[model samples]
Target: MNQQQSLFDVEETIRNSKSQKASEILTPSTRKILQLLTSQRINKVVTASLLDLAGASHEIVQYIVGPIVTQQNGWQQSIPSWVGKAIAVDRLDTALKEIDKGEVGKLASSSEVVALMMPIAFEVPLSSEWTDVYLWASYDALLRHRPFENFKYDKLWEKIGTTPIQYEKIRSDYETLAADIRSRIVKHAAKEGWGKRSSNKNKHPVKATTTESNIQMEQLSLFS
Candidate 1:
């Protein structure tokens, strides 16, 4: 199926998933934020900040609703900062390159810019609880308002003058690099024992107290 259709199917599946109630879709504010991000006329920085705001607001929801939801169904929630960092870095790089080539003015709209940013930004949280929630939320948003096809591949190449093969390779490498970074973070967390610390401590005997107690016991024995 086409990208839009696939996204729609994913959304339907998430809506019907056993882990989430059918009514628990994206919040209206979240939808509005995403809509702004997908709008062609919005500034890129504004879009990014909206995304950041959405993330921050979600933290509150996760804190309040997270425990009950997880207890009922063993769900978890995480923000996956590494993924965000990677995407943000990638977008900055792309923007810089486009600016350097004097091609920034050629873009049709911000929606096109976000489309170009998808492969980098399409990341889920590291923990399973957070991952599931993020995936469901993202899938819901994409289904309601698909933005993948807005990327003008032709215009992008025209601006950057890169061949399709080169672009594909770059995209593939970017994905691989991000995956590697995530894997390393996971491994490090595991090796560190999930941030838990050992609770054992050794105590030394008080030599002066021990000697005084022995002398008192000897005096008591002589009196007996």
Candidate 2:
């Protein structure tokens, strides 16, 4: 009798947990931000960062979104400061040297430049310290529509010559990267104990806050 009662208690607890989750509500600010993501009005992974920052002080949101918002509104800017943010700086330098030696002859387009860069960029493990620095530098360059932003392009031009790729192609590539980075962010959140996995194998658990769960649902509705 006691054993049967214990199993019933466990089932009851799980039911209550599921009920709580199903009843979660979205705050107004979170709902607005999620609408932006769902409608594809703001299509970068930075929108996920904004979802993370929502419900914090207004100043924090402004500080985080100011430059991106400005760029969205037709103000062109380059993040020149991302020049040397790589952990494996030597790796990139060596790749440049190899290119100079004609290891790959005439990188005719930005996609080829990215092909050369991909291996060197990911040589460091994504779980290793400072990995996000490298990832963000890569993501930001694409976000700013400057695929060659991290390279010493003047020096590169002198070596492999000018490699121009279409803006539409770059945008398509950015969409793929954004999807990848969104997955990484969720896994990282789980590692940090801010998220819990659901019973559904396909769904990733998000942080158990009103805003976070709402954001997660919005992402899932659009993506999954």
Candidate 3:
């Protein structure tokens, strides 16, 4: 097929995937954040203000974006071992610090930081089965980052050899894993009474904000 034909065929295939109910829940800022996340290089820092523009919470953004970016950029898997342990250690240390600093409000604007520290939270231990699944899904998504690829159902099932009857099982397993980790982390933070103090620090001053906004506006206008 010609290049144009190939592109069109790919687009058509993507459109045929099982559709979720359309929800108007995502704000414009959230949509923008998703877009930014979808385009980022793995391990790259996406700044707080950019997240503010995207309207995504830190937890949600980290949950969704971290795996994809890391996978695409090539990183370690989530299996329990020294590597996982090391990751867990790092997470713990960071969480403790963030909580002590009362930087909870910054969570919404700091997905990369959260992603790095989540596995260490008391509730979300790195060795837990749930953490494995969460890391696995994120890694898988990253590994298969092509716009037209369907990792959720297709490739994932193929890996586990339970594509048909086990599709639900696979999804359930992963969801359980992710949820467990998230719960643990939150609980740990709460138990430690972290995030009581707030930092009034501003990374971007008013002058920089205005300049960046103007640049973003120009880019938007071009697209429009």
Candidate 4:
């Protein structure tokens, strides 16, 4: 069949991945198969049962028809289906973490942050081009620097998964997102006054009565 036919269900797969938190919730086998199914080099020829194993039991179509993502006007090529699923999951999870206000303590359940988080947890749309445009803008800004001209999102994510820096600035530059996350987490925790500090229950006892040495001296005097 043609490439178009193979990718017919790409949208549905992406929707399920987002709704089910496939990145965080799917069985490992399902996740692996989902990732494999997105490849351009895999010949797009998996059977329907394979997709079922990847958690798409509803799909009964036998063959992969074509590319999963429809080509957009300005895009040089079709964005990979897995890319949207994974990124949407990331954005949703991050927003949820922020709304939980560092951790789920009593504060989290009733805090302003939860109210804040409940609204934005899944607010980011998978088709939102804002992030992609930002990444492209970031690459453009860094292009003047050596080794950064080769910046690409896949390379950036790959390096983030590895030791980061080898031949490009992708590692250091990409990790700014991690730093931002940490900063936000700290901010949330601080907002609720929720970090480690000496509690009154754990404080040192005050010097009560007299010292052991003083007590011994008093006993000796009495004996004397």
Please report how far candidate 4 places residue 164 from its true position, in Å: 6.5
Worst 10 residues of 3 by lDDT: 214-223
Q: Please give the ranking of all candidate structures by TM-score, highest first, separated by commas.
A: 3, 2, 1, 4
lDDT of 3 at 174: 53
What lDDT does the true structure give each of the candidates? 0.28, 0.30, 0.31, 0.29
The lDDT of model 1 is 0.28
| Best of the candidates, lDDT | 3
- TM-scores of the candidates are 0.22, 0.25, 0.31, 0.20
The digit string of per-residue lDDT tens for model 3 on 1-224 reads 33234323323332343142112223333333323332321121222222222232344223221221111111113322322222222332333344335353222111222233233333334554444444454444334332335545446545644322322434665544335444444444334332222220143211211211111100001001
- Best by TM-score, which number? 3
Count backbone overlaps in model 1. 5
TM-score of 1: 0.22
Better of 1 and 2 by TM-score: 2
Screening candidate 1 with a backbone cut-off below 3 angstroms (N, C-alpha, C), the clashing residue pairs are: 76-129, 76-130, 77-129, 77-130, 78-130
Question: What would the TM-score be for candidate 3 when compared with the true structure?
Answer: 0.31
Off by over 4 Å in 3: 1-30, 42-49, 52-144, 147-167, 170-173, 184-200, 203-224
Per-residue lDDT over 1-224 for candidate 1, one digit per residue giving the tens place of the 0 to 100 score: 43234334433443344353212333443343334332322222232222222222222111111111111111112322222222333333333344234342221112222222232234422453333323333332333344457655335434334332332333443344333333333343344333121210111111111111110000101001
lDDT of model 4 at position 203? 27
